[model samples]
Target: DVKVTQSSRYLVKRTGEKVFLECVQDMDHENMFWYRQDPGLGLRLIYFSYDVKMKEKGDIPEGYSVSREKKERFSLILESASTNQTSMYLCASLTVRTGRGTEAFFGQGTRLTVV
Candidate 1:
């Protein structure tokens, strides 16, 4: 079965600290995305990668960066964690099939708390 796994399901970090959130997919998906979920703002994209070593900033990328060193792995980095950054982080992998449309699979999610 295809699976998207997150390194941690819950995390707590101090303000101004560096944080790493990792995600991995077993389906060898070509597209990966990082998103954060807030109370009323919904899910907002932070970054995405189409292929290995290729990444693009998404809607809210100001306080985040991403790394895709391999096809199956994507990593989100918080340069300096802040209280405002506390939220539920999600990692997703997309599979685009010819004439079949695209399907996205998401990890369980990492709930990060910045103190």
Candidate 2:
């Protein structure tokens, strides 16, 4: 079974603190993505990496960044966390080359709260 694992299920941090969210996937997927879900705003992509050492910013990349050092591991970093940045973060992996209709497998997600 394809699985994506997030290091933490919940996190609470003070403003201005740095936070790190980690994700790993068992499937040797070619693409990994990080998204944040907010009320009404829906799921917005924060970043995605198509290959190792390569990353692309998504819709809402501000205050967020990602790292894909290894094929199966992707990390999302919140540089100086803020209250508005608090939300549910999700990590997903997919093999886009597996055909046009390939689906992404998602991790359970991490709910972060900033105060």
Candidate 3:
């Protein structure tokens, strides 16, 4: 099974503080993604990496960035935390070669509360 592990289950960041959330996948999948889940907004992508050193901005990439220095590891960086950025952050991965939706495996999730 594909396992995505997040660095933290929860985090609290003060306004303007920089925050980092890490994710690692056991599977050799090529695609990794980061998203913030909100009540009515569902899951909005923040960033994704298809290969080491390659990163792509997702729908909601503002105030965020990412790093993929290793095939199995990905990181999300919040340049400046704000109350609006507080949300449940989830990490996922998939194999683009697979036609199957593969239902992106998710991390336990990091509930980030920016105060």
Who wins the TM-score comparison?
1
lDDT per residue as tens, model 2, 26-102: 98898999999999998899999999999999999999888899999999999999999989999999875446787
The candidate with the higher TM-score, 1 or 2, is 1
Sum up the clashes in candidate 2: 0
Residue pairs whose backbone atoms clash in candidate 3 = none
Candidate 2 runs further than 4 Å off: 97-100
Name the better of 1 and 3 by TM-score: 1
Relative to the unseen true structure, what is the C-alpha lDDT of residue 80 in candidate 2, on a scale of 0 to 100? 96
The segments of candidate 1 whose C-alpha lies over 4 angstroms from its true place after superposition are none
Determine the C-alpha RMSD for candidate 2 after optimal superposition of all C-alphas: 1.4
For residues 71-109, what per-residue lDDT tens digits would candidate 3 score against the true structure?
999999999888999999999998644576556788999
The Cα local distance difference test for each model comes to 0.97, 0.94, 0.92
On the 0 to 100 scale, the lDDT of residue 39 in model 3 is 95
Q: What is the clash tally of candidate 1?
A: 0
lDDT of 1 by residue, 1-115 (tens): 7799999999999999999999999998999999999999998999999999999999999989999999999999999999999999999999988999998999999999999
Worst 10 residues of 2 by lDDT: 94-103
Root-mean-square deviation (CA) per prediction: 0.9, 1.4, 1.5
In order of appearance, the predictions have TM-scores of: 0.97, 0.95, 0.93
User: What TM-score number comes out for model 2?
Assistant: 0.95
Assess candidate 3 and give its lDDT: 0.92
Number of the top lDDT candidate: 1
